[model samples]
Target: MRDEKWTARIEAGVEGLTKAEWAPDSRNILCFSEWGLRVTIWSLSTGTATYIQFPKHPDRGYAFRKDGRYFVLAERYKSKDMMGVYDCPSGYKLIRHFALPTTSLASISLSPTGNHVAAWEAASEFKVVIMNLTGQHIATFIPTDDPLLGVRHILWHPSGTYLLVGGWDSKLYILSSLEWKVVATIQLASRLPSSTACCTIHSS
Candidate 1:
């Protein structure tokens, strides 16, 4: 008794939706549910959905790559934090799982070139971690304390040469990817609110 004209809908007897997005390729729809414990990739042409499982619940720090080839998720397993890269074409199969040094489980971002990844730590204020796809720790940046506390967000430059880290401290930290160090810091007149942040990029 259902109409075929409807685009698509999740089948009954499943968990509710947490988040959804269209794959960059536009041919498929990616859905996350159970707080990242379950993923379903729905095909528009074939009208079928494939389910994928995660080892742990991915709270919020997760995003698919630009090319739709992969996705990065900061997952919580056994009370520990982990970073996972899953292959997009293979029903979201796990490709790599990197154990994070901290337990913040904050936001994560991938470099434009797909070579590096960065994560913000909330448990420890003003700490950012940089790493590669091979589970090797590249560098950790812990800047001087300010009124702004934990890192709120992380963004990578299009050139993949630098990163921008923002925090509650009312400042932005520009980090060099190559040198793995803070090259400059921009301070504001006021402390950034705990729930608010700023991010910008300009090439000179």
Candidate 2:
């Protein structure tokens, strides 16, 4: 702070509050209510507040664009998985609201380019659904058919050319962006297999 003589007080809309965060721009604050009820955004510059209800998770259900121009939040509305995108600079205006084709959305991630969003099905299902800005379905992918497979997290590469998915089954799936195909799979294990042997590398 330029001067240590400035102070402002902000309060949550409800009594039982949980997670409180600052928007990327540092001009606004996001407060998540207890029991997944709602999120209140309090603006420091304008001294105003905005509320969004049914936040999927207090810590990980929302993401903001790198530049803070946009915000994507996952919500549960009417017993269905819904997503809302907000325009940050314009006072968190609702730019788009749409339903997702998922049973229980675990988490969501916005591509670095801000062109698409990826949502994954929660435990007991291994599904990742990608969608464009207009709410059109792009593709849904299941890395494995094992009944125990479940998606734990999903993220996009900084270049926005690849997507990385982590699973409860202990594996990582890399998907190419344009074609939306699994480019590689990285498996995690406690030890090497019996058939696997040590190898040597030679440089000439």
Each candidate's TM vs. the true structure? 0.78, 0.87
Question: What lDDT tens digits, residue by residue, belong to model 1 across residues 57-107?
Answer: 434676777777987777776678787888878766788987987775567
The local distance difference test score of model 2 is: 0.86
Which model scores highest in lDDT?
Answer: 2
Candidate 2 local lDDT, 56-122, one digit each (tens): 8888868898778989999999999999989988888999999999978888889999888999887
In model 2, the worst 10-residue window by lDDT is: 6-15
Best by TM-score: 2
Once fitted onto the true fold, the runs of candidate 1 whose alpha carbons sit more than 4 angstroms away are 1-6, 12-14, 45-48, 54-59, 146-148, 191-204
29 in model 2: Cα distance from truth in Å?
0.6
Q: Can you tell me which runs of candidate 2 are displaced by over 4 Å?
A: 1-4, 191-204
